[model samples]
Target: MNTGKAHKSGLRVVASHSSLWGRFLQGDRHAFAEIYEAHIDDLFHYGMHFCQEKERVKDCLQDLFQDLWSSRAHLSPNVLHIRYYLLSSLRRRLLRALRKDRRYQHRESWEAFEFEYTLPQENQLIINETIAEQKRLLHKALSSLTRRQREAIYLRFFQNLRYDEVAEIMSMQVDSVYNTISKAIGLLKKQLPLPLLLLLLGK
Candidate 1:
């Protein structure tokens, strides 16, 4: 697995983002803009998953960046992943905004992470019936998971966050995050072949 190479790569990522964060905190306009460019799409993606309203997501993102710039002087310099920091900020903003709006009163908590699998036209035609059925089963199993379970999976796999980062973002204990992901994976394993399951889960 080339553990040494992997460790070096991880350190590189931390150094890159940590340096950028420091620059931004020092009031570097270019660094601030670069951070926005790198994370805006991912923030928006996570926002949409948390709340389906596109306009709301855009509004929250705009506000988030605006606030970041305004408050940069007081911001902490310890951010390792700008993506993770921005995601956590956007999440808080969305939840607060949703709570204030009377229309969203029915949503007592964050809903399950929602997603659909899609294939390109050429690839779709080549997918046999067996594979199609397996896809259906996978989707069904995903839907059956609790909101927290689905969210843990999304942040762990789709967002590619470390388990500890996911725990912090979700306000869960590290042990709880491990258990949640383990349970979710166990359930998914029952629905598909091991080879296909690993591929679908982005393992």
Candidate 2:
């Protein structure tokens, strides 16, 4: 089927789905606004995980949406989830940014930048202060991983991409992706305390 027809058919599956995707396909401002509102936080966190620089992540996000809008005319309405596509695009943009910027070339492991202490605040509205301590510990653990391990973990768990998709994005062989994810998970399992790991696994 043609892109538009397929999109229309997909929309018929649900009212909420049709309205949002339809508006996005047609370049509606309010629709795009809703989309941004729904996704910005997740996107920011994902970008922060990879880029490590706040300003660079912000700039990359701006460039990402601009490119998405510019190319929206060619999009398939049947695209079930736009968030995944945007994230893949953002990853590419981040890699490009790293390649072009020398300052981002620090080869030190992210663990070197981990916070040494936990916070005891739960009064903030914007930030989930209750989760601050756990978040810091998790962040420190994540930072301890190698760059490839971090990317593999993010792609597998955070972005929810398949091994093949991750391999393609990272320009590595499928076996490499699989090995990287396995190694990363193994390391995390070993390093995290049993209780915390169980909490993470909901066990």
RMSD list, candidates in order:
5.0, 9.5
Backbone steric clashes in candidate 1, count: 0
State in Å the error of residue 43, model 1: 0.2
User: Model 2 misses residue 41 by how many Å?
Assistant: 1.1
> What global local distance difference test value does model 1 have?
0.77
Tell me each candidate's TM-score: 0.78, 0.64
Regions of model 1 farther than 4 Å from truth: 1-17, 108-112, 118-127, 193-203
- Candidate 2 per-residue lDDT over residues 28-67, each given as its tens digit: 9888888888888888887887767889889999998887
In the range 103-198, model 1's lDDT, one tens digit per residue, is 988763445487576644554465555567767776787677778888887887788787778889999997787788777777766756674664
Model 1 weakest lDDT span, ten residues long: 1-10
Q: How many backbone clashes does candidate 2 have?
A: 0
Kindly report which residue stretches of model 2 are placed more than 4 angstroms away from their true locations once superposed.
Answer: 1-19, 106-144, 190-203
Each model's lDDT: 0.77, 0.69
